[model samples]
Target: MNKLTLLLFWLMPICLYCQEDYDFDALLDSTSVLSEQGAYEQCFQILGDLRQYLRENPDKEKLFFLNIHEAYDYTRFGYYSKAECLFKESIQLAKELGDKWNEAYAWYGLGYVTQDKVLSNSSLPPSEEGKRAFFEAIELLKAEGDSAFLVDAYDAQGYAFFLEGKFSEAIEYGEMALELCLKLNDCESEPNILSNLSEYYLAIDDFSTGKKHLQASLKWIKEHPGEIADEIAYNVYRNQADILIHEGKIAEGEQLAMKVLEYAMEHKDPYLLRETNKMLIDYAAARGDYEKAFQLQQTFMSQLDSLHEMQLVLSHDRNQTLLNIGLRDKEYQLLGAKLYSQRVITWSAVGLIVLLLGLLSTVFILNRQSKQFNAKLKKEVERQTKELRISNEALERFAYVASHDLRTPLRNVISFIGLIQRRLKNHNDADLNSFIQYAKDYANHMNRLLNDILDYSKMGERRLVATPTGIDLNQIMEKVFPMVKDDFREKQGILEVGLLPTVYGDETSLIRLFQNLLENAITYNDKETPLVAVQLHSVANGHAVFCVSDNGIGIDHAYHEKVFEMFTRLHNMEQYPGTGLGLAICKRIVNDMGGEIWMDSSEGAGTSVFFTLPLIEVEHEQQSQENGAKAAMAVA
Candidate 1:
């Protein structure tokens, strides 16, 4: 089966509920079509509505099935982690209901969804977790004697084996699945399995058997046209033509190949067209048409070269969608909270009015107490107003800087794209390639800038809720080293660690802080022997001070404060490469943790980055103080 057909099959929702009762068949069909057409937002909106409806109605079975579909949708579109979580939920739901059938399907979903590697040796599973899930699924389905999903499970295993290069195992599994499909009268899967088997046979050099399977698949397609997927039918034709060409049936093979090529061109399927061109090249070579072969090979290479550009665009779109989805989730949560808060405030105002009416007579008698109450209320309101203003101003400033920085890279990309287009028209391959590479670089830079902006915006949102468990600096360095090990090796840099202390902070944030500081230390250095030293200072006043000293070209005192500002860069891109928000993020993280971060250095001298983290003992002391105050209040 072709990739599109396989994706459609894999994403097909396994409905355990009655479509007539739900009256959602039309909706499901529409969403499925939209998903297939790559209109993910439309699909998501429809699915989201269905999800909300299910939440209100509380149908566990329908919801579970819907979750599988949604998970598969995400999986098909490269959202692996999100898909894995949803598949896990589906498994749990099926287990809770003791529904082995659904559980089996859920496990099957997880097997494919969570498998990271495209292929692995039979000696080692593509993904051990995925392999285990597949086995568990097969066992459960086999126990229940359920052949409907079992056929699919077997087919999946066959594909898995094929990808692993275990051809014998793949054939075994494929035959098993085909047998089950025939027994169940499942025409839909039978043809696909036959086509798959034909490929396997061809790979093993059993042309006779391969031809038989291909012929069988074609016969099925001709007989059951409505049941066969378009891509599957196309594959059957393509493979048959390939076999014919290899068997010296040039005229017949060329006709079939041309038909397939026409279809691919009409559908604008560059990949399939490229494949057809390759097969034609082989046919031309067989016929001793060397000139035609060379021309076809050049066309194939051009198409193959364009695939990277296609992939780059696809990657950008997927990333943008993921980012938009994340931001939307945050916005939704904030909107919900704001709505709740507004409702509370509205009710509170009504209550306050009623209280004022009831206490109108007693107000004059309690004037002094009322005055104190008014004073406190006014002070609280003023404090909140000031905080709101500061937040607004900060948000506005961030937006401006983010837009400007983001637009600069985008402009570079657009300008280079135009250059490449013009060069393409002129047929200047060298200029076109140069401009294409530049555009790609600018796109990458833009992506990085956007990520940095996102980080800066999110820093305040996560207001460092100090965890009770302290973070060990040594462990953090160990964790962070791998991320920059290549850079360190490339620069021949050395790092020295000293005795470190446990500090109260968020581990993830601290890791980012240390990583940025260390990276900058290595990146900015012009020393003959670059060295970065991390050490702990004596604890004082409930804080643990630390220093990351580096033998690098030091920053001047004039630009020290500017370094902690968003998008602030003291050096040009040629001299240093970064989004310039790393130190800003580090500063925000430190301040959120109730600590300070600063640099102590001057130009031409080595730099030392000093930061302080709250001592774990200080957190304990604060907790004790809070407990004592609560006890005193209770006694009073």
Candidate 2:
């Protein structure tokens, strides 16, 4: 009888723990339903309540799940920093508790948030950090023998690969994910995985395979209708339309594309709307409807611009919300301080009248401070709003310029191709050669334009944060001179090099800057013999300034700064045979290196480009000495 009692006692805690877990799981299911219904705030409130209860109860197991859900919720709302912090905390807690399932989920949440951050900030979609996190999650889930979360992990891997443009790997992983979903009997996830696979196949131009996957996804969506069904079906239909359009089923593709647009509008999915508009624009262009195509293009650009503006607004709102929360916390602290002072006054109430006067003064001071804080917050919000508006307007103007400039060359290419095709039927070799040459020239110009544009845009992403490294500008110039040596020899250009100094910067960017300037000097010169000279001099604070001067057909005073604006060409394509992106690229590269670049030129005179760079060795030595002094002071 004693032994039986001992067994029951031992089992009691186990049974209680299981019951607690069950209760938490049920609440989690409710939260999932709310989230799926798009009631994120309500879902968050429920999660908050659960968290409060967990805080009171102090259950490590329950806290793990709560943190994971909260982190994921934050990520969904673009609270990347908060989500990242929570995910890291949850991961540590899960590891301490030996909860492998929650650990995997935490890692997956972190990865998803990182991916979203990359996508928001960059045009490119590839994310190495996200891929690593998802792979780690997959391994953990596999070890746990968890089929449910494993499906998601596999799908995320596939999605990452797709973004990275690894089409074959994406298709393989997508198939693996779909198979797992089917095996797990997760009908809701199965359709989305199939849709993902279809998109992958479409990316690789495998229309038949893409069609097959789309059919499968459509069948599943129809069989198991849910909120996810609508979202995934929208993408599936869009891909199907794309495949149809590629296969010459124009009317059918247009119909499907229109349906996708309608669904996107109903759901208010801006991304999907933009994608559908792009498809419609392509269709119009294909059907030889230039007017319709132009209108659709304008609408597409407007929508894209608006989407960019909306993103800025959302980011600003998030910051504003955080600021308000901080203010509330500060108010709470001030209230606590007031209460403390009042308590002290009450305890020391040798004179009740003095205590009353003290309380009154405290109240007045607190009110004034609160008013001041509120006023400051209002001013900050207004300033940020104005700055955002200015940035958006500038971006819109840039987009217009880019579109107009890029389209002009493409239009020429198309016209030349059409001419070649029509004249090819007449069997005239001479005309064919001329048309083909024109097409080739335009193609080369387009290639140069695209390269320069890519370089300009990638400035923000590349290696721009490292400490300056010492490099000899003379060696850089020598290396660059060879690239334009033929042009110099052909033009009989007299290239003079003064004593160039070693400076600190990205060597590749510096070389490209010199190469472009020299190329421009040679290419733009109409003189029988061109003269180009480069010289350097010492500047303040361990810096060297350099100037590249050329006796080429100089720029007008009015167009001096304009030359640095992208695609601002004064000469026609026939005369220049180049895109007007070189100076702009050079200026951006110079600025990125913590230097300035400007032109000193006038019409009929020579042009001179000047820039500066830091002297790296001297700067590094000075920084070391300063750090040592700081450390010595701290120790003292």
lDDT of 1 at 392: 45
TM-score of 1: 0.48
lDDT of 2 at 421: 62
Model 1 agreement with the true structure over 1-636: per-residue lDDT tens digits: 346444433343222121224455556565667677787765665576566457547878888888888888887776665677788899999998889989998899988875533421111224455766777888899999988788878888887777668999989989999999999874478888998899788768798999998888888888875887776688778888889889988789879988887776555455457667877897798788876676676556545434533543454477566555444433433343344445445555566666866454444435554456456545654664565455444553554465556666677766777776676766756754664665555466656776776666666655634453587666676677778667767887777766666788888888889889988998999987788877776688999998999889999999988898766778877688887789989998898888999889999898998999898743344443444333223222
- Model 2 Cα lDDT, one tens digit per residue, 1-636: 245334433443343333344356666556665555555545554565465456447888778777877777677666676677788888889899988888898889888887776645533343454558898899999999988888888888888788778988888888888888888774557778888898888777787888898898888777766757466778988988898888888889889888887776565467688767877787678788766776666566545544654664565565555445434434433444445445555555655565778766766666676667556656655665665455444444454456556766676766777676676766757754664665556566666765676566555445445455788666676677668778888887777766666677887788888889989988888888788877764577676787888888899889888889766789998787677788988888888777877889987788988877776533344443444333223222
Model 1, position 181, has a per-residue lDDT of: 91
TM-scores for the candidates: 0.48, 0.48
**lDDT (C-alpha) at residue 389 in model 2:** 56
Each model's total of backbone clashes: 0, 0
Best candidate, lDDT: 1
